[model samples]
Target: MDFTQAVEIAKHIYWIGMYLENDPFQCHPYFIENGDESILIDPGSMLEFEAVVRKVNTISSMKNIKYIILHHQDPDLAAAVPEMEKLIDRSDLLVITHSRMVPLVKHYLIRSDYYEIDKHGHQLVSGDLHLQFVTTPYCHSPGAFVTYEPFTKTLFSGDIFGGIEESWEFFAGKDYFEKAKPFHAEYMPSRDIFNYALTKIEKLELEMIAPQHGSIIQKEKIAGLIEKMKALECGLYIEKEYKDRLIHTIEELKEKDLALRASMQEIKEKEELLFQKAKMADMGEMIANIAHQWRQPLALNNTLISILKEKNQQEALRSTELAEKLQEMENNIQYMSKTIDDFMHFFHPKKEKNLFLISEVVRHTLEITDPMLKKAGVSLTFEISSEEAVEGYMNEYMQVVISILHNAKDTLLHRKTKDPDISLRLYENGKDVVLDIGDNAGGVQQENIHRIFDPYFTTKHKSLGTGLGLYISKMIIEKNMDGTLSISNTQDGALFRITLPRQSKTGKTDATQPDH
Candidate 1:
């Protein structure tokens, strides 16, 4: 029911992160005791929070642990944050982690005091222990970082050197290099990310290696483990069959690259003209859209013309009533002219980066695509929780929104989901303004989820899809605007979330009511 003993893993560092007797994997969360201040590294998951707290209490008072070092925001390593915060009655308990992760980690912690370590590396002094927080993005998480204790010369490697085990042990054996190999390959993104992590560890003057999940490799074998890790292929790199295929892909890409070099100017103009190309694509998508666009106004204009024709044919085109009929026809013509203006305005790129209300952008997109969505028999609903402005290409932003709307409409009809509905929620999250677009169509198959953003990749039929919708959306958001566009499969269907940094309200787009 209690931790057996206080096993001093290093100078002032204790092995508080324990494994369950029934559980298969060993997740080691370490504790550093320096003066009245104590730092805990990777407090275990909510389920294991009690066990972790029980162990820590036996060694020292829970109130003294002033800081928590999180390598990454994994459930196994950091989900216990909320529970742990509830037990402690102190205010200085800053959760030491990454900056980009502050918002998400706080959502779980219920508190937001943090010292984010820079990706390059940052150091903080704790008594004699100089803690190094080295960021390793995409190793496992975008905000992943491992802590190093220079005082003990022990590197708490987080999940980097983690291994698989059927039993628990304090330190890793000489054969651990082989044991940990498979774990890294499966958990880490790729060798490119793995090698980036390796480079981080290789730079450290390490005497011992302590990982959260498996055994700790001692000083004598640290170099050997490093050497083994350097040589081992993990993740996609282990797929030897893909080697020739990858080479072939590279060769094909080289030919494409040579051709692309000639069109570098047009390539730079890649997405600026995306709207016109998609609208004019030989698929006649726009032709159908134009039909929808002109449907209402044209019908009214035709009715007015017919009224005039009937009166003239009957020889009753009197001067007393002719003015009203002419005025009615003029109003209908104006409506059609406005429709053409809206369509032209949407296709032109507003290349200037300026502050524009996100809600307006979203509303305008809805206006442009409303006719099409209605035609597709999909009910579209959107809620603007609050108004926030962002700096970017307003027209380009519209393209992204429209593309997503079209995607949802297509999926809803294509999947034939009952009572097809697409819901959009716009709100603020930390420093970013977020838009959540969810649908009631069947969710994407799990197999295709990961490759959803890959260029030239699509699930729709070849004729109906070029597969560039999501790829271009991702690029425009992430690369062009320094924002994030992510999607996940929901219970109802697919959920697309776009997060863009909210710009300062310095230069707002001049006041004008939304058109539609």
Candidate 2:
């Protein structure tokens, strides 16, 4: 429970989050020491980056951080990713997350390629390290998920079981569920969605629940906590609107006095009936999605079994080949049979395309980059000359902006510019929107300008730049958004311009864009 250093809660799991006294919402970032293939889960916000990094370094080197598991897109759990990736200094380190989270999480301008759990069969195997992911969409966010380590029987439950406690501890006591209920009531969408996530957790051979916030739940308290969460009145049922209305109605009935008791009884019965009907409808929809998600995996497992039987009958089955096939089939069957109930919810309505203001994207991007700029004593100026709307991937566009700003920041700092400055201007050009970002650092050399967008080309020290930033930025702007990314040198510095059509021509809804 000590927050002074990394606490090994399990054999290989370490609690590496920062401790802020009396803070209701404390973030917990965990580190798993799997030798060289160690993993960091929910690396936390920029505020805790230094503390988290120091704690991680105490037990293991940053270079050994092979995978960063992002539970969702919230800044409290993800904003430090860009900075952490730079410090980890491993080119092969990957950000493991759900495919539905790729769009938003990518806006942090992460350099490493993503190992999307949904696309990669919901499990990862590297060296002797094995991780299974569980989808728990809408337990908070649409792409919300959790990581389960079978060896330790520990579930990294993200915000699903997280609490807001004024007095915090590393491990949950019996009163943990009461502390966690308020968070679920405020953040979760409905009790049914929460119960769906609980059902998934119940299926796992869970010994502990290491969530992104609050205390970690031990095995002895796990079952009781799950049941309490299942029957808890949270989300829509206990939201301010519903609670206030119910209270007001009861108060009016009490004022009337004549049929107060009868009316109260009738209202309670009607409310229960309505809630049951709604819960049933929600459950049916969940069942349908589960069936849809299981179909492909089930079919594939069946095909593998058929192939195995035919090979055995023909007497052509090599022992090694048969063993591999059986293992593969077993994995498939396990996935299909015990799949996360809301796995298909990644395709929920939240992922659909919608119009977004260009100004808002710039604002959100600055909210992250501005702090870094100030810390480095670099001045930043921005202008929103137009209120243009772009019907493309807003988060992806934000990534493009962040990537450019990050490069500029590095360049200015590396050169030791006396009065470093970055300027941003967004305006409408014909039917397209144009964004111009310029920096006061010396302009790119003529020879390097042509090759700037080339992959693996860098004018930076080996550790400072991967040369992938400009390359991927071009790909995201040109290929994904049907836009153009071009650069020109002003009298004082280099200026990067991004031009995009106001409306999306491809109508692409896929959040998982190609990394290249």
Candidate 3:
């Protein structure tokens, strides 16, 4: 067990391996031999205490050990002190650690004389070897310390530069950087401790690094490694040259996303404008129908009034006939008042589904569109079916009718035919009510037929059309009112047809106007 060897530095200094070949605990102990006095640095584990004593026996010959320098109180480094004392008989000086580690070292090595080393530059002189203790706490443990020999410039770093691996090769393996990087990152207890220790070591110009569990380093690599550890300990978010490039990329993406959102918003606004235009066109057609409805009643009322004025002065005027004429005039006035009510309700904006007479909706829509049709010199015709009670949103249904009537009126006006005619037909088909509107004007263009219902797609002049009319009308009838609308270009003109369910899809019948 002669595990001691002296390197030719200044005096006889021996390096001893307590259990370098063992499985669990492997430590290297260095002995500084100066004439008669000796200093032992980290004397191996408790299990290898017998081997260390035997090895020390071969060199000293006297069973007396002078001093034991405990760098750290960790078991793997300084665990054998209690057992070593029993074998050797001498006035041994136990150079213990800092005040923080006194409790731990005292718990294990109870009878040994303790000497505390505090502060930065503390030295222990044992003949030729002057052991300068550098306080480097928090590198791996709270009571961690590194011993530097000023004579040989050899640093006994406890676990600061140590890494895990059983290989005897001192420098790390082929993938040294990769293996050593995580050993410090994952296993090191505190980053603050590592940083504080690194700052203290940077001031030292060391030539050799004899770590506790690993091989010795004696070049610029130790300093370089400590520099990197200091950088990591401070903070992991150090700014680099590539940070600007990443920021620029993020800004570009944000700008692109903003542009896309703006484009989508513009498209939505355009769609809404088109729907408004369609509704206006429908309103115009409704006005023409209203004019047609009021024409006969108003004219007849005027004629009756004129005749009554003339009869009032005539001798042939009789009381019986006067009553009949007066009663007839009263009926006409009541009819006109009813027409006004229908007109008011139809023009009102808020329109949702409800139970109402189909005939009233038709009459109100016609009243709103009649004036426009008459102004355009388009003749109106109506073939009303059975006067049945239907369930739906009144205004929405009227809007559909208005859109159809307006399209017919526009066709007739644009055609400028000698005989302009627009016809409205209503009938019951199975369980649904169907309305068909036709005109004697030229039909829509063949190529533009399919695009009639697409938003912003219109065949009329841009100033006269918003292109949303048909699209919105289609949405109102199909989605809101749960009805269907269709169009066809016939021989004479364009025909628009609409079908509505007798009962609402939701099965709830509303009898009032719906909120728009």
lDDT score for candidate 2 against the true structure: 0.81
lDDT of 1: 0.77
Expressed as tens digits, the lDDT of each residue in 36-146 for candidate 3 is: 556677887866566666656666632446677777778877778767766655566465566667788887755767767774247777656677778876556677788
Q: Please report the TM-score between candidate 3 and the true structure.
A: 0.41
Q: State the lDDT of candidate 2 residue by residue for 309-374, as single tens digits.
A: 898899999999988988988887776655452233211314335687777778756754554576
Better of 1 and 3 by TM-score: 1
**CA shift of 140, model 3, Å:** 2.3
TM-score of 1: 0.47
Comparing 1 and 3 on lDDT, the stronger one: 1
Misplaced by over 4 Å in model 1 are: 1-3, 119-121, 238-244, 250-516
Weakest lDDT window of 10 consecutive positions for candidate 3 = 507-516
Badly placed stretches (over 4 Å) of model 3 are: 1-11, 18-25, 61-64, 119-121, 170-182, 231-516
For candidate 1, write residues 349-452 as lDDT tens digits.
77778888888888877776777877887777777665888888787777788778777887877788889998888878888889999998877889999999
